[model samples]
Target: MTDPIPEGAQEIIHDTWEDGAKRSAFYTLDGQQVGYRSWTAEGQIDMEYGIQDGVQHGVFRTWHENGQLCELSSL
Candidate 1:
């Protein structure tokens, strides 16, 4: 199963490498990362990875801009 989104987390969005692509990082209120999601400059999802209790966990995946799965792994 997919990891559940952390409750009460704060979200921060940033541009990657000064490119138009966006990355969203999620953190607990106290400031520990919970997960991240990144998108291409054109807004296509590029990757998603989960973290829990300060450790990587659950499903991690990456996709090509054309929407083809590029990688998939379990933490």
Candidate 2:
């Protein structure tokens, strides 16, 4: 699997989405998004996915609000 956090990534911005989920978005120094990890409103991890060359790539995962893993997939 491709590593989401690449050496080129130099920023991590934490923000809340319109859907109310909080996320930490990884970006390169020039502002290319590399990957993100998201959490539900109650703070449980909701999903994690990677990006490559501006497209979704690598392993993708999701979890239930109760903390159990809901899915594990690859792209």
Largest lDDT belongs to which candidate?
A: 2
| Error at 30, model 1, angstroms | 8.1
- For candidate 1, lDDT tens digit of each residue in 1-75? 464346676767745645645655554556777777777767787887777787777788889879998988887
Mark the regions of model 1 whose C-alpha exceeds 4 Å error after superposition.
1-10, 16-21, 27-32
Model 2: CA > 4 A from native: 1-11, 17-21, 27-31
lDDT of 1 at 36: 75
For residues 2-75, write the lDDT of model 2, one tens digit per residue: 54456666657579767755555555646677777777767777887777788887888888888997988888
Error of 2 at 27 (Å): 4.4
Q: Find the candidate with the highest TM-score and give its number.
A: 2
Superposition error at 32 for model 1 (Å): 4.6
| Candidate 1: worst-modelled 10 consecutive residues by lDDT | 20-29
Which pairs clash (backbone N, Cα, C closer than 3 Å) in model 1?
none
Give candidate 2's total backbone clashes: 0
